[model samples]
Target: MPDEPAPITEHLGELRKRIFWILATLLVFSAIAFSFAEQIFLFLLEPVIAVMEDRGSKLQAISPTETFFTYLKAALLAGFMASLPVTFWHLWAFVSPGLYSQERRAVIPFVFASSLLFAGGAVFGYTQVFPLVFEFLSGFDTSGLIEQSWTMSLAFSTTARLFLAFGVAFELPVLIFFLAATGIVSARKLWSGTPYAVLGIFVTAAILTPPDFVSQVLLAIPMLVLYLLGVGVAWIFDPERRRERIQARDEESPGEPGSDSEDHSE
Candidate 1:
């Protein structure tokens, strides 16, 4: 007989262990990142600083602890990015118990795809969205007006938030793939839920991005694109689709009565 499913308590225990390891990885990477927080800050600021230069605007800190805290947050964000491989592995481990042996074998591809999507999201946000957001916000500062000073903490926090948000957003396809693999969600189901999913994506974009139409819309468009991509992922891994194909093949070949079903059931 096939092995029995694990009890809920065992599943919960497994989840707790995974979370502990993931947190440990985050801490390790965060420590590594803290050593180079200054470099990360300077790299992130390049776009905004260039825009700020035109208007003599400067990034400053109001509170004494702002810089320290910002650096800490930056380190955390960097650590989170660096730990994507560990994070993805934990995610796969958490779900793999429910997957068929064939599905479990795709771990390397799953981890690689998830990590690549995360990096792609961060790059898109920095390259395409960041410049537009910085340009629009910076345009308001006129050199003639009172000195334009942006808070160091605010800038860094916003950058980190958007980077993290984009990275998470880009994991949609991977999420769908696993859901399909586990028989939790199918492409047909996703299609039926499209309207609600879109509403949720836009709302998430509005929440995560700066309070600007361009920023929010920029985030939303790519997410919608990813949603389409995720639907494709769902279609490919969807067991319902696979079952249908198998049934069709069996019907065409007219295999021995109940043999295919028995083999599959076994």
Candidate 2:
């Protein structure tokens, strides 16, 4: 027999517990990141620094608290990055009770893949996307008539947004895997909806990326690739679809007695 559904109060309590643990994890990691805030800040600033060096530009602090706040934001970003694995684990734990035994067995792989993909996305944004964006932005000073000093706050916010956008975007495959595994969507349906998915992806890219064609295209390309990859993942792991295919094949072949009854029982 299946387990009973959890009571509403129990569900709420579980949610609260998950939230508390996630918050605690965030705080602890944030504290650790704060200790290395300067290094994190510098690491994130590399692309900007490269562009600025080429153009002899410098970053400035417009307000007295700007530098402090920028460092604080950087620490928060770093903390979140460091705590991502724990966060994902908590998320999986929270939802695992609704999954089958076989599905629950996927927790470790899910957490590991989610973390790896997010970090890979962030690194790609920093190393490949940011440099191109910064280089493009630097070109606006071709006339050299205007001063090209960017404030620390602006730089931090811009880089942080892109880092976050890429990280979240990279989770597409994992999200699709879950949806497929849960029977919310199927690989065949996703494949048939390719055009619509491409459209949605471009729209999402436009929303997430900076307001420039180059940035939009760069983000969209990866997102499109990830979507296709997600469809492949869904095809491979979707149990419902696999069962349907098996049923269809069985119906087409000459079957032993009681096969239909066995299928109905299943």
Best model number under TM-score: 2
Tell me the alpha-carbon RMSD of every candidate. 5.0, 4.4
Among all windows of 10 consecutive residues in model 1, the one with the lowest summed lDDT is 139-148
Candidate 2 regions exceeding 4 Å error are 248-266
- Which residues of candidate 1, in runs, are more than 4 Å off? 1-3, 141-146, 254-266
The sequence of per-residue lDDT tens digits that candidate 1 reaches over residues 15-119 is 999999999999999999999998988787777777777776778889999999888888888898889899999998887776668877899999999999999
The ten-residue window of minimal lDDT in model 2 covers 1-10
lDDT of candidates 1 onward, in order? 0.86, 0.89
Please write out the lDDT profile of model 2 over residues 207-248, one tens digit for every residue: 888788877888888989999999999999888768988999
lDDT score for residue 43 of model 2: 92
Cα-based lDDT at residue 104, candidate 1: 79
TM-scores for all candidates: the values are 0.88, 0.92
